[model samples]
Target chain A: MVNKFSIKNLDMYYGDFQALINVNMEILDKEITALIGPSGCGKSTFLRTLNRMNDLIEGVRVEGEILLDGENIYKDIDVTKLRTRIGMVFQKPNPFPMSVYDNVAYGPRAHGIKKKAELDEIVEKSLRRAAIWDEVKDRIKKNALSLSGGQQQRICIARALAVDPEVLLMDEPTSALDPISTLKVEDLAEELKKDITIIIVTHNMQQAARISDKTAFFLNGELIEFDETDIIFSVPKDKRTEDYITGRFG
Target chain B: MKKKINFKEGLIYGIIGVATLFTIGILVFILGFIFSKGLPHLDSHFLTSQFDSTSAYVDVKLSEGTENPLGLILGEMTLKEKGSIEKQVIVVKDIEKTSLAESAVNNKGQNLAISKNDIINRIEGENVEGKSVDEVNQILNSINADKVTLRITKQGGGIFPMLMTTLMMIGLALLFSVPIGVLAAIYLVEYAKPGRFVNLVRFATESLAGIPSIIYGLFGMILFVMTLNFGYSLLAGALTLSIILLPVIIRQTEESLKAVPDSYREASFGLGANKIYTISRVIIPTAMPGIVVAIILSIGRIVGESAALLLTAGTAAKIPSSLFESGSTLTVKAYTLAKEEANIELASAIGSVIIIIILILNALSKLLSRKITKI
Candidate 1:
């Protein structure tokens, strides 16, 4: 629960095509780590591997040691439990055709939280932690779809937190929203890092630099560089990282 | 000067427009004639009645104070063959017009009592001297509607029972078609490996859809009715409807499943849920509107069917007590009324009922789907 994910020699393939190769990294305990790369450069692929999500695809094969808290996840992990522990928020807000309160409580219910009072407390606390409680408190029973895009996204973040996961994975969570919504998610992510370790896959280099403590740059399924956020942006060791950050070539 | 313009294109455009209009006009004319010929029979009794096709019964009262008045023909037959005297029959004023047996007693509740002069008058009335046989026959066959009326009533059945049967049949069919169709679609979208077997399964599903309803009905009869000893039951009718609806359900559900963007599935799986859970919770709910539309179309087809139910479900106009009972549906009633008695009015009334039912069902489905698909 305290220690975070450690991935080593991770390889992923879609049939004969290689999508990620030799991905090695450690997500620090209770810290925000940013995965930065161009589109289709395997940063999102790396984020997905933490939850063993790629296994759902036909003809997908993985060879990797993805450990959560010193336990090898790929060897004997119950993926449902693994996923509930490492909760994820998606690129677009995917609230259930349900009330905002129910949307936040879904993960906990799936994990067998049946008492209404317990679920109510969890929903409230999670929404408050996501910094969206005040805006949505009066209308929790209304449909989540009626909310603004940013509020919906925050509700989804609240949904992820309602299960009390040790880690939260965000795969370009603000990519589908407007700038204002993105700013809200960025601020929420900044606050969430106080208690939970956050792994974010982002295309925006400036957002990664502004938010995360550690930053890892990837190029063509390979990790080009990994360093502290300030060093990765200001004094990176690799030329590819510098080129990608400066928008020279993808 | 006019001939210098593009006459060929103008002629082609005029011809195409004329052809399209003509085609539409022909369809409208055919429908209009059939409906107009059929629509007038719409009434409460017409809707509620059935055709016995056996006989016409009328009680002939000797009308007013002329003692022992003569029976007469109305000459009101629609079939006008000028020379035929085939339907000519002498009838006594003391009997019902439906049966050939003359009564031994009259309406005064007295026995046949004829005086010598009365017998002589009857003997003279029987002769057709100086008259054509057909003319004389017309005179003898007419009956006054005020004194006696002959209306066609069903032997032992009406259309209401059949209306209930068909509704239940369609409901069961929808129940059968929806869940399996959705699951098959989910498998195709979320689970099936791309291969020869998968392609063959998809092709089979499509082929099942194209099979005619009559063929499905026959199969249902053989499999569910005769072989299984269901004996013209609602289950058999429902089974036939389900087979007919299967292709429709699968095709629509598959299209809807495909319509849901792949990103949603990826989003769900990324949350660590399995493929099954993702499909049931996310993919299916997202594609539900199309599935509901498909179900509505299937229900329409099932409700409008006649030929299929005729063979499998039987044409007995009885209330079904159970799924095993032979029952007639509204479509079957229409067919029976229109053909057996040539009663177009009752047929139209039935048609109108069927149309209203289908419209209500489709509207209800659309409303429910809209509610669910509120986003």
Candidate 2:
């Protein structure tokens, strides 16, 4: 399998406090890679560094190389262009206070797609791909925030997909969702990895085992173990990974 | 524990009720006072007509004289002061006016066999019989072949012009201040790094807000009016008011911008939007309510502003022909009318109109904000 992202000796700091320490991982193209960890385990931090979303924080120091398609994203790539290629969905659903149609078209519009017919086609296609077209086609002009939490999250996924990104990063996207919504998102992620690379940070180990092909276990800013999901779930090399997986201590 | 909580809750509820009632009562009393005093004087004529302080109409009686009474009034008449009545004796000028006055004499059916001096003497008589003021004015109006030019002094020049000036000043002030203030706020909230200079700037903004409006008036007088040679113009007043409103707008806009969730910014950025695009598209739309509140507050301040305008935009009650000309706003006109003319009713009428305008503005902005939030 071709590698979409290659990280080497990654370290991240907020002011003087270290959040991510010497993390190395390869995320494969057209595959689902799940990062699972306990609370404050830096799994989400590692997810943010992929698209350089961490640059918004004040006094943030990063010492690492994050390469996307053989180009060092941290050094050579323009952050805005890099973000276009790597999309993100936060844990909590945050739809812009706008119409559902506008929300889906926001990304395309931002990148200078001004034609109405073009936007309409893109909105329909993206919403269809995000699996929300049937649920929302009639009320596409309605406010995005007026929808239910699950539907709004799906709309956000549609919004992110409207830009046609190469990679999608979801940071505990299902944590705020109900069980049904969580299953729907899991299924969506499973289907989406056929076309785009996805790196998800999840606390639900069973969810990680169910959807992800490869899983990386992190503990206290350290990558404890990384292997195929079945191996990590059944016979992990590290005791900590095994303990976390078996529900002894998370 | 439940009983103790009930007593505390009752106390708090009582306090809140009293506070709310006190606020409502004061508002009712002020509205009642203005309406009662102002409603009677708020006619269309009072709102539209123009008058000057220099001229007045006086009633004069004519005594019976022997022979032809030379009945003609002309320009440049000399008046002798009487008890609240000024009797003016005039010589004849302009043959057309002489003919008009002759018709008045014929209408009264009096014998006109007198000289101009005799006419003057007759007009000065104490116990003379003559037409009433209204009757004379009617006769003068009809016979003149021109029009009645009653120089009614001590009348208000209407509030319409002052209202226009007030609106214009507000528009100009908002135009000048909103952009600068919002941009400055954006810089402070979105772009500025935490440092000593940013802290100092914040402190300066706070201090500017705390400064009295009178001080702003003084500064405006010196800087805009005198040094800039604006000469108490509308532009000067708008510039001065913009400075006064700047700190408030900046602070409120900053607060509103800060109130926008970090998640929205992240979402916008994650879509490959740059800082400017994200701020314009996401952050500003969400913070629009608070920004509008700031603008409305600034408008309220501008509308009620008198002292600052009196110093910067001189108390000329006439409509300004251009932005560079001097004019009085509604509040300044109210102050001038109340103090100089001592016409409390006219001032109250102006105050009432101002209140109505502000109420409309507030309601419109609220409706607009509601629409924005709904979208």
Docking class of 2: medium
RMSD of each: 9.8, 9.3
TM-score each candidate.
0.78, 0.82
> Residue-wise lDDT of candidate 2 within A1-250, one digit each (tens)?
8889999999999999999989998888999999998999999989998999999998889998999998999889999899999999999999999899999999999999999999999999999999999999999999998998999999999999999999999999998999999898889998898889999999998899899999999999989898899999999999999899889997
What digit string (tens of lDDT, one per residue) describes model 2 on residues B1-375? 999999999999999999999999999999989878988878775666553322233232232341212234333344444355655433333333233332232223443332222222223123212334343333443432232222212333467678778889999999999999999999999999989989998999999999988899999999999999999999999999999999999998998898888999999999999989999999998999889988988998899898889999998877789888999899998899899978788788888888887898788778866755554
Question: Would you give me the overall lDDT of model 2?
Answer: 0.82
lDDT of 2 at B64: 30
Model 1, residue A231: C-alpha shift (Å): 0.9
The regions of model 1 sitting more than 4 angstroms off are A1-3, B1-12, B47-158, B270-283, B359-375
